[model samples]
Target: MFLRKIANAIGGLLFLALFLTFLVQITARFGFNQPLPWSDELAVILYLWVILWACAFVVPEKEHVMFDLVWNSVSPTTRRLMRLVGHTLIGGLAIAAIPASWSYVHFMAREKTAVLGLSFEWVFLPFVLLLLSLAARSWHGLVQAMNNRDLDIHEANP
Candidate 1:
């Protein structure tokens, strides 16, 4: 889908930025004998964005870690039931945390990073996006489970 492509693009861009930041940090530290103070902070922030962004958007559901000892042993009916219960729990918890997460991110507006002086809210905003993405993904899973789709536990994507 178009949205998925955009998400992938964003994730790729974030990773590229993180790589460039590290290159800058390393080059300055060794080549110039003077490390940039803000580079470290920027790198950390970009790393966080890259990881959470990948998890929330780029990665597919089947690619995630699964304790499949039970899932693999289950029947199709049981697997559907498990999907329903699992998605419900995950989506419910993610939805429940949204308000608190938003509040904390908003409250962090006054705080700034040590070296970059970037507001904490902007730094932490990806967390909110992650939570929202989790909830949305779970909802989609729930719907698919209800429709009896994706009940089989495949070893790999075909």
Candidate 2:
């Protein structure tokens, strides 16, 4: 629940910032005789942040697009097995991504944004957070599956 709130708040704020920046840029460029050069760069960064953080919300919400036709048609035992396999795979992938993303962040830690002059590592921080959240969700799913709980075809909260 706390994670959901944080994810939503961060995503919402980033999207709002991006929208306001774009509006301001448009007003400056057209209404006034000047433009905000940093607006575009800021928007890009905000867009990245919005996407990365929103994944954490989506994973637990089961909001991501999935082919649920087969899932819905499966028998109980098959469904349980599928859930176990799916959760394991997701957990493994998230675990794998952490070190890879960490290394990449470190490799580009010295690099800065062209306009904001912020470290690239800072920009990439949300990717790590996204992976960690997904990993937690995956673990939750795995535990649920092991306990003989029926996985939802479309929705679950971790």
Candidate 3:
């Protein structure tokens, strides 16, 4: 619960930061003769982090996309089983993605982008943490499904 609050607070700030970056970029382009070289680049990078970070906070809210038509068609017990299985797969992917991305981020630390002139690792590092957080969230969802306690679950009927 404490961790979730921290994630939410961080996500909210990141979102605001992303918005501020856009505003700054627009202001610089219009208000000044020259635009900031790294504004859009950093904005884009932060946008990615905001997205991935938002995912962790969202999963508990059952915000991920789903194929409801198929799941709705199944029996209640079957539906529950399928939900568990699907969440397990997602959790596994998040788990795998963390390590995979960490390795890539580590590799990128040795170099930096030209315009941004910042270590790519700094931008990419959050993705690893986000992926791991997602894994944790998905695993939590899987447990909720097993206990039939998930409130926002969806299913496909066909």
Best by lDDT, which number? 1
How much lDDT does each candidate structure score?
0.91, 0.83, 0.78
Pick by lDDT: 2 or 3, better one = 2
Ranking by lDDT: 1, 2, 3
Cα lDDT tens digits, model 1, 17-59, are: 9999999999999999998988999999999889889999999
Per-residue error for 89 in candidate 2, Å, reads 1.0
> What TM-score quantifies how close candidate 2 is to the native fold?
0.89
Error of 2 at 9 (Å): 2.3
Q: Which stretches in model 2 have alpha-carbon errors above 4 Å?
A: 155-158
Model 3: per-residue lDDT, tens digit, 78-122? 877886887789789888777678889999999987787889998
- Lowest lDDT block of 10, candidate 1: 149-158
- Position 15, candidate 1: lDDT: 95
Measure candidate 3: CA RMSD: 3.7
Q: For model 2, how does the per-residue alpha-carbon lDDT over 1-158 read when each residue is reduced to its tens digit?
A: 79667767777888899899989989988999698879878888888888887776644446677888888888878899998999899999999989988899888889999989989998888888888888988898898899987477455533
